[model samples]
Target chain A: DQQVKQNSPSLSVQEGRISILNCDYTNSMFDYFLWYKKYPAEGPTFLISISSIKDKNEDGRFTVFLNKSAKHLSLHIVPSQPGDSAVYFCAGTNNNAGNMLTFGGGTRLMVKP
Target chain B: GAGVSQSPRYKVAKRGRDVALRCDSISGHVTLYWYRQTLGQGSEVLTYSQSDAQRDKSGRPSGRFSAERPERSVSTLKIQRTEQGDSAVYLCASSPPPDRELAYEQYFGPGTRLTVT
Candidate 1:
């Protein structure tokens, strides 16, 4: 069984618009979530992360919202830039297992200019 | 200043062949992890090491999969009697110890794509 899942296979957004990517996880033990962005021929880089203790966390144009009751989380990118085009993966982990992360299949995001 | 790195970025192995993939983690990082990414699947943790000790191997698919960290800086993932189903991208990541101030984040390598045929 997949502990984490990203329902959408792909998403497209116009530059300067808002892009939302959603993720759901079944593991209630997960207390922290992370998002990583990957470009072709490169490794996935850490984009943003949020602790389950907080409902939301933001960094510049990127914001992550978590709804524990719903077992859902969403990543919001405002004023999306063409450079933001890449595959986004969401991961969840329990505090006890800090080194092992459970990842979603990933969502491809394309920001058109 | 360097991040984690994996060697033999692409490897094509014939079925039944044995292969070894290497990873070089950043200097001073005490924790290292290996993960496998298969088509249409999320990345799965194969193993993790701390300093020079092998900490976990529960995620390994079978006896054919084995990993070793001879030292703190380098790790090797070895496959014996490879099968076509073994094809996947192997990724390595490293991070500081949990006691450190850094959050539970890991720095990943570009990964080695293994095609077993």
Candidate 2:
């Protein structure tokens, strides 16, 4: 069974627009959520994260919103640039479990110029 | 100053052969993890080590798989009698000590892609 899921397989957005990626989880024990961006052959690079305590967290052009009650979260990138195009993965972890993460399949985003 | 790194970026092994993958975590990082990512799938934990002590290894798939961290900074994942299903991208990541007040962000290495023929 998949504990975390990214329903959308791909997304596309034009430059200067906002791109939103959504994720959902079935495990209530997860208290921490993180986002990572991956290139073709490189490992994933950490992006922003949101603790269950807060509803939203933002860094520069990236923002993550968590809705614990709904077991859902979303990542928003404003003024999307072409460089932002890549595969995005959302992961959840229960710190007590040695911080092992359960990740969503991934969402590929294409930002057009 | 360097990020995590793995050796043998690509390996092709025949069925029933054994293969070993290596990982070098950043200096001073106390926690390391191994994960496997199959095509079109997210990563799954394989094992974890902290300060040279393995804290969790329940994610190991079977007896054919094992891992060791003789030192705090480097680790190895070995697969014996490899099978076609064992093919995947094996990733290694490292993190600083867990802190309740801070997020333990794991830095990953360019994974070693293992292909079983």
Candidate 3:
């Protein structure tokens, strides 16, 4: 079974607007969450991460919000640029399992300029 | 020299043939990982190594699939008697020591796409 789930397959936003991507998990043992952005034919790059102890973390124009009670998290990109158009994946770590990471399907974000 | 590098950007192999994919991690990185990504799906962890020692192999798909790292800097993933179902993009990543309080960030390579005919 999939422990991590990104229900949205795609999202669209206009330039200079806020783009939000959502993800959910079924495994309660996951204590750390991360976001990765990938371009076609390239490897995924780390974006931002948040610990279970905190509900939110921000870096520059990127922010991640985690709601432990609902087992849900989100990544927000403000002033979304054309260069920001790519697939975003949400991953979680199960510390009990030697930091094994589980990934979601991914969301393809398209920013219209 | 700066990021993870993988060899053979693309490979097409006939069924029952053996294939090897290579990964070179950044210098001084202690943790290495292998993952497989199928089309339209998320990546799945296949194995992990720390300083030339494999730490986890639970996600290995089958006996035909094996991995090794003779040194701390490079790793190889081998698939023997590859089947048609073995087609996927294999990814390699490296990271600093895993942190208990925070998730260790992994730097990934471009990946090698293997197509088993």
Candidate 4:
């Protein structure tokens, strides 16, 4: 069973618009969530993260919101740039998940200029 | 030395062959991890080693997969009796011990693409 899930396989947004990517988790034990971006033939790079203690966290044009009760999280990119196009993966882990992360299949984000 | 380095960026092995993939973690990073990304699959943790000792391996996909870190800085994932289903990109990452109160940002290597015919 997949503990973490990203329902959308792809998303497209116009440059300067807001892009929202959603993720859901089945395990309520997860306390921390992270997002990573990957380009072709490269490893996934850490993008942003949010802890359960807070409902939201933002960095530059990127914001991550977590709804603990709903077991859902979303990543928002405002003023999306063409460079933001890549595969986005949502990952989750708990204090006791043995420090191992569970990752979603990933969502491909495309920003049109 | 500079960052995590994986050797032989690509390797092609025939079915039933044995293969070894290597990883060199950043200096002083005590936590090392191995993960695999198969087509249409998420990056799945295969094993983790802390300062040369494997702490958990429940994520290992099968008996054909084996990993070892004899030292704090280097690790190797070896596959025996390779099968066509074994093709995928193998990634290695390392981070400072979480006890250090450092961000759990794992620095990853370019990865080794294993293609089994």
Candidate 5:
């Protein structure tokens, strides 16, 4: 079963606009969440992460919001740049899971300049 | 100073042939992980290395898949009698020992694309 899911397969936005990507999870044991950005033929790179205790974490133009009650989280990139066009995958993990990361299907974000 | 490195970034194997994919983790990192990326599943953990126990192979699809970590810094994933269903991009990642109250962040290699023809 897919414990973590990203329903949106693709998204498009204009430069300088806010790009929001959403993800949902079914496993309650997951206490930590992270976002990774991947380019064609390249491995994913770490973007941002949030702990279960917090509702929101922001770094520069990127922010992550978590809603524990709904088992959902989202990543927001503001003033989106063309360089941000890539596939984004969200992952979940917990201390008891032996550091194994459960990933979503991924969302491809395209930013038009 | 380098991240994870994978060799022979691409491989093509005939059905029923055996193929070995390699991964080199960052120096001093204690954990190595293998994952396969399929069209629908994105990426799923195939296995990971552990300190005190035999490596975890629970995610491996079948007995045709096996992995060996002879040294802490290197690992190899072997697929025997490959099938077309096994065609996918296999990725490798490494991380240091995890700390409580914090998340384990893994650095990944570019991945090796294996095509079974």
Candidate 6:
């Protein structure tokens, strides 16, 4: 069974608009959630992360909201730029599990200029 | 100043061949991890090593897969008798120990794409 899932295979947004990507996970033990962005032929880069203790975390134009009770999380990118186009992966892990992460299938985000 | 790196960015192998993929983690990082991403799938953890000792390997798909991190700086993922189903992009990541909160995030390599015929 997939512990983490990104139901949407892709998302598109016009530049300067808000882009929202959603993720759902079944593992209740997961306490740490993270987002990673990947460009073709490049490694994934850490984007942001949130601990279960908090409902939201933000970094500049990027914000991650977690609804632990719903086992759902969403990544919001405001004023999306063409440079933000990439594959976004949501990952989860139990802090006690020593950093081994379980990743979602990924959502391809395309920000049109 | 370098991030994790994997060698032979792309590899094509015939069936029954043995292949070894290498990863070089950033200096001083004490934890290394191996993961595989198949087409249309998420990256799955294959194994993890702390320092020079393997902490978990339960994710290795089968007996054909094995990994080693010697000297705590570099790691190798070896596949024996490769099969077509074994094709995937193998990714390596590393991070500092958990004691350093900000450094706990993993840095990934570009990944080695292995295609088995």
Q: What is the TM-score of chain A alone in each candidate?
A: 0.97, 0.99, 0.98, 0.97, 0.99, 0.98
| Model 6 per-residue lDDT at B34 | 86
For model 1, name the residue pairs that clash.
Answer: none
Model 4 has how many clashing residue pairs? 0
TM-score of each predicted structure versus truth: 0.96, 0.96, 0.95, 0.94, 0.94, 0.96
DockQ of each: 0.74, 0.77, 0.76, 0.64, 0.74, 0.81
Residue-level lDDT for A58 in candidate 1: 99
Residue pairs in candidate 5 whose N, alpha carbon or C atoms collide under 3 angstroms: none
Clashes of 6: 0
lDDT of 3 by residue, B3-77 (tens): 999999999999999999999998878777888988668999888767768533656557777788877899888
Comparing 4 with 5 on DockQ, the higher-scoring candidate is 5
Evaluate chain B of model 3: give its TM-score.
0.88
lDDT of 6 by residue, A8-62 (tens): 9999999999999999999999988999999999989999999999999999999
DockQ-based ranking: 6, 2, 3, 5, 1, 4
Q: Chain A TM-score of model 2 versus the true structure?
A: 0.99
Summed over model 2, clashes come to: 0
Each candidate: RMSD: 1.3, 1.4, 1.7, 1.7, 1.7, 1.3
Model 2 per-residue lDDT tens digits across residues A1-113? 88999999999999999999999999999989999999999998899899989999999999999999899999999989999999999999887887887889999999999
Candidate with the greatest lDDT versus the true structure: 6
Worst 10 contiguous positions by lDDT, candidate 6 chain A: A93-102
- C-alpha lDDT of residue B82 in model 4: 94
Fraction of true contacts reproduced, model 3?
0.66
Candidate 6's displacement at residue B4, Å, is: 0.7
**Which lDDT tens digits does candidate 6 get at residues B7-107?**
98999999999999999999989878888997668999987778778534646557877888766789988889999988999999998877788554899
lDDT of 5 at A23: 97
The per-residue C-alpha lDDT of model 5 at residue B30 equals 74
Instruction: Kindly list the per-residue Cα lDDT of model 5 for residues B1-117, writing each as its tens digit.
Output: 989999879999999999999998888787778889987577998887764334545554578877788777888888899999999999998777675233378788999999999
Worst 10 residues of 6 chain B by lDDT: B53-62
